[model samples]
Target: MGKPTGFLEYKREAPQKKDPFERTKNWQEFQLFMPEDKLRQQGARCMDCAIPFCQAGTTMAGSGEIGCPVYNLIPEWNDLVYRGKWREALDRLHKTNNFPEFTGRVCPAPCEGSCTVALNGDPVTIKSIEYHIVERGFQEGWIQPEPPKTRTGKHVAVVGSGPAGLAAAAQLNKAGHTVTVFERDDRIGGLLTYGIPDVKLANEVVERRVQLLEAEGITFKTEVEIGVDITAEELETSFDAVILATGATKPREVQAPGKELNGIHYAMDFLTANTKSLLNSQLADGEFISAKGKHVIVIGGGDTGADCITTSIRHGAASVIQFDINKQKGAMRSGDNVWPLYPIIHTVEDAHKEAMAVYGKDPRSYMLQTKAFFGNQDGQVTGLQTVEVTTELKNGQKIRTEIPGTERTWKADLILLAIGFTGPEQELLQQLGIETTSRTTVKAPYGKYTTSKPGIFAAGDNRRGQSLVVWAIHEGREAARECDRYLMGSTRLP
Candidate 1:
């Protein structure tokens, strides 16, 4: 709140992005940094509302009424940034979020959705300001490793190096406990390193944070899986506390005719392979599922679906199309979509924009459901059959009905499933002897994060199903606080 009238005077100015066609030429990040003067102006647009629902971080109305799950000190940081207190702004940012850079880049920013200013006009540039604060902190050398002065002599084992596991390890180490993170992959940063493409989140950004965690005394052991490389019994005996953040790697699939076609693959498998290959040899290793010169059909219309389209276009796919089971949303919010809730409106994503620039049209087809797949004698997928459907929102539930005589075949050589995930894989959970919910997530209550087995805790997608990265960070921090109390009969973490 630098100036009381700043919200009205200074209109929202988003950071410039590289041309879609130009950015697709390579895998480099497309977003360019905003000027410092403009960032300060954007921060001043924060209206000092009495009750900032921006940080409510709760669900309401069985609706999408959610906000910043990490509950960052939004107003404080906004004010600090407006007043040019760059270092102080970074401090307020880190007070709530362990990894602002990741959230700043990838988070949907429910904080903006729930901002009071959005009731009339645009919300403050909360996400951009947060991103710049941490980036500036690193550039100005304000961020550095500060190892705990004393050791508690307790050991913690975190299985997974994703956002949640890393957050838990960071907090546990801050409390003077020895923390060791185990990842099945050769490199650390589970989903961050592989699930997400480097175009959206560069590899170096993750590596920078990992290096800092190492300097702060947290240990990361890659290529060592708990259920395979190391026994769960060994983990139980070796550490005072154990955290399961392996995430929901189980990909949701469609059970249609000819589903076993060779070209059909899970979105994560495609993204992971592409990222790994890119890092290893800029995709020269031919280790990834290439969309080059092939017709790609992606199912599911969520963030992952968007990513699949973007990645395919970057790979020089001949034709790319996305199928969405739900009907297309409107540009404006519906009557049911009230304030403080995430506005249910349609907006073109960067991925769609890129697709349009390359394909000369948006690649998304709405209200379409898969029926079956068609494959050649060689077992390679050739196309898919789908039926047009109508959707209705009855009593806040989506009811989809397939229309008769609307089934049609669409040609495709490659299909990527981006629907979502069922829950965490059961192998590690079973080996650890921990109880899971009916949905397959570990049976850890929200806020309490306690599993069936004593001394065992779970968080992130493993505990909450597939969700935003910010929520994973929130649960990880809270779990660490609870784990610390369990280890020492009391806790100093916040």
Candidate 2:
């Protein structure tokens, strides 16, 4: 709990972000750090609710209904940070989450929504406070590698090097198990390394954490893909246990006429290429993909689409348009969308705001459906035919009906498909004889995290499908605890 009168004394204040015009021209993070004094004030706003829903991390019914996925001791840590006990606050944060810095930057802060203060006013800036605490911990040299003093003879193999795998590997190593992580890519940190752009998540943060894990005696093998170049049989024989964190990467595609056009690219391809190129040489040799002088059309209205929009603007696209199938949401909180639930309000994101600053208007159009893709003789995409559709809930089912006379055509040279991921890739799961759901996620009991194969566990996007990094970290920690118990008849890693 924070100061008894702190909620009344302090108003919520989040960190300031860089101006859109200046930020869009470069591939740097836009989030501004709050001054220590300001961050302390924000942390003090945490109220001592009799029933703290903020740390209750469950997704079933009213259980996971509020707060954070990692079930972080929000009130306690907030109080610690407010009292200027930065190291203690970091310890409290690490008790639940292995990586507060990652969550602090990218998590949507569902816990903030579940805050009592949010019922009437803005929630305490939990995410920003988290960012400040962890950043301070590093600055004060409190964050150091704590390798287990003793070693357990058992060994564990983690597939994929994303948040989940990285978290599990770190925790398992702390438990003194000889842990080795296998990443398919040339670099470690799965989506964090490739899929996400530098503007959102800088690569150095990921590399730093990974380096800590390395210093703690964990081994990372990059460019060694399991089930492809390496076989599951080899891994099963080599390691005592296997934890699969291969994320849900199979991108959802919008199939239409002329789908094979040269200019059409998966959002991941564009993002990954851009990030790799930037890191490799900052595109100095002119080897990076450029959206310059092109009319860009980004499909899918989720975060990925927003990323594509911003990237295109930064790359100097002539025009950019975002097509969303869902209806436009309200500008502010609605009657049905009360506090403690994520407010489903329409607002400009960093990318959208940047696009507007340059384009003079938001780039999204609601209720638009792509009818077909038009291509030129050189197999390059030229345009797309679209029809406006209205969404209605008919007989307990959501439906989309095309509106008459709303069909139109738009010019485009580049198209980025960002329709989100379907699920974990099926081919590898099938190869391992691990059962999967219709949604393509690994079939395992909730909380248990046990796969069909004994000594094999699955978590993160691989088990739950594409989700927030916080959720993935939560599952990774939970699964690691379970895996430890399975390995050694009992456990204390949680």
In terms of lDDT, the best-performing candidate is: 1
Query: TM-scores for all candidates?
Result: 0.98, 0.96
Residues 1-494, model 2: lDDT tens digits: 65888888987777999999999879998898788888778878888678777777755443234578888988898888788888899999889888988988878788887888878777888888888888888889999999999998999999999999998998899889999999988889898888778888899999988988999999999999899888988889999999999999999888778888899999988988888888988877666667999999999999888989888998999999999999899877777666566667787788888888999999999999899999888999999999999988777577989999999999999999999999998877877899989888999876889999999999899899888898889888888988999999999987
The window of 10 residues in a row where model 2 has the poorest summed lDDT is: 57-66
Give the Cα error of residue 158 in candidate 1, in Å: 0.3
Return the lDDT, model 2, position 267. Answer: 91
State the displacement of the C-alpha of residue 418, model 1, in Å, after optimal TM-score superposition.
0.6
lDDT over C-alpha atoms for residue 193 of model 1: 91
In model 2, which regions exceed 4 Å deviation? Answer: 60-65, 285-287, 334-336, 393-397
lDDT of 1: 0.92
| Cα RMSD for candidates in order | 1.1, 1.7
